[model samples]
Target: MKSLVFRVFAVFTLVLVAAVSGCGQKGPVLNVYNWGDYIDESVLHDFEKKYNIRVNYDTFATNEDMYVKIKAGGSTYDVLFPSDYMIKRMIDEDMLEKLDFNNIPNYKYINDSFKNLEYDPNNEYSVPYMWGTVGILYNKKMVQEKPDSWGILWDKRYAKQILMMDSQRDSIGITLKYLGYSMNTKNPKELEEAKQALIKQKPLVLAYVVDEVKDKMIAGEAALAVVWSGDAIYCMRENPDLDYVIPKEGSNLWFDAMVIPKGTKRKKEAELFINYMCETDVAFRNTDYIGYSSPHTEAVKKLPAEIRNSRTAYPTEEDMANCEIFAHLGSMLKEFDRIWTEIKSN
Candidate 1:
């Protein structure tokens, strides 16, 4: 998710009534790792100013990249922002610490609908942050016909004008969905089919990009792109010519959440930071600034009606019925990696 927020009409009524209290004494730097360009940088500035606890904020481009760095035993990250399936994988591997919900009192503001997700069924190790769907973002001027199916991505006319995600999980997962297979398919044959499908479509794709896809789409540089809904919102505001859709074939409904690592020495401080992030104003700032869907009930209520009701950001339940939350792949992830490498190289 990235920023260039909505018109949001004029000013919203969201307010933070009380100033946060400073940590009594200086503590070790709170090492936080999150997705690149996914948050409002000013939030970190404010959190720092409030707590007097220095934050060493860093970012990763993908979940796999972050997992590898954290799993290798050299890096010391205290808090991580990982998507649903990756969070499950980290928990299974014992890489995450069980969150002490008592410290996250603001958790009460989180929507019940977003709670108890399969990836964190018990809600023990992770806290929901931003959620969104994967869909097609296209320039309305360039695409005259309805871009309602993933199959359009393969249409010959759109060749050299389509952007696919650079991430292995997303690009491969959508291809699996397009082929009537589970995105978490552990079946070798099903995965092979998705792999072949992507290889065939490679010639049609203009580029494999992540965040850059947003800028390119906003500038009307591409006819279509596989993008996160949050990015689609940002692009739509910048270029009304841009629009988004969850294809008829269905797609991934994803959640990115916060979790502390297993070996953090500053656990309580990390909890404080997490609670602070969930505060109404902070949550609203992050959601508005980044254009992502916040799980915080109060924060969402504070959003302008346009954003609150935007079909792109919040699809109807019936439309969402076919969508799936990604599941931890375990050993099958290696197969996904192999398929992705071949797709990119082929």
Candidate 2:
């Protein structure tokens, strides 16, 4: 009897020890992939310290690069920051996981206008990170009058003094908008028109670039350029003469969202991170650090009056209504790429 009792006690002790050891061990970590210099680094560090989980971050210059890498299964990333159109494509490819909203309590702080967007109509798969427009940013000192039209980029006066984003989407989309066609237009005729317009303007530009446009524009290397609102904001800080404007014709309205990638083992942690970013205070911190607009309504309310009222950040209702949010163009993207390559090579 005593031997049987000893055996039972020994087995129970081993089971308890195994369970406790498992409980103490950490789970798989999070891998975050995002745009370069798009977020505040401190927020990431604080998240790591608070959660006791390691976060590995990576960056891509363009969404196409990110899509290609992710689709190739080159790396396993727990989270990705993608713009609206890319999110649509990712969803169609089943690359993103459906978010567990209950875990993201701070989501309620997001502006209602930002929710139910065409890309994530139900908001089941992504959370808004930053929202802005693609517009003209110019050095006022070089131009006697502010540029309110896309044609300013093609003006003979600004020749060799213009910089344009190297991105296929922004460059093509803006030309399409300038031509009075939908940025998401798949119409061959409209696309051809946009292509011709770009070719005409190509000789006038200093260079097609993404990063350092702010610095170049501020240093007076370029007098006018098409730039993202966030980048425009950065330029304004260095040179007060810098001005951002949504062309009277229109511009692309872009929203980048944080999403959990499929196959992530840290779903709970990923959800927590999203919620943490959505919190009013945290959202404000990110906007302050990144100099972009926050989509959280409560956070927007707390921003400085000058920032909250900046027409460039939050355009008037009429201007907002005129702007079209980019939609996934499917196969039309290939056509754009071919033309873009030809344009750049020439």
Which candidate wins on lDDT? 1
Model 2, residue 144: distance off in Å is: 1.9
lDDT of 2 at 169: 80
**Candidate 1, residues 1-346: lDDT per residue as tens digits?**
1232432322231222122223423555798999998899999999998988889899998788999999998888899999999999998988999999999999999889889999988889988999999999988899989788899999999999999999888898898889988887888888899889899999999999987998899887889999999989988999999889998778999999999999999999999999999999999999999899999989989999999999898788866777899998787778888888887777
Query: Where does candidate 1 clash, by residue pair?
Result: none
Please provide, for model 2 over 1-346, each residue's C-alpha lDDT reduced to its tens digit, 9 standing for 90 to 100.
9999999999999999999767646754678999898878888889888888777789998888999998988588888999999999999999899999999989888888899999998888999999999899888889878787898888998889999999888898888888788888888898888888888998999999878897798888888888988888888888898899999889889899999888887899889888888978789888988888888998889889998899877777777766888888888779989889878877
Model 2 residue 225 lDDT score: 82
* Model 1 ranges off by over 4 Å: 1-25
RMSD of each: 12.0, 7.8
- Candidate 1 at 152: error in angstroms? 1.2
Q: Poorest 10 consecutive residues of model 2 by lDDT?
A: 20-29
Model 2 misplacement above 4 A = 1-28
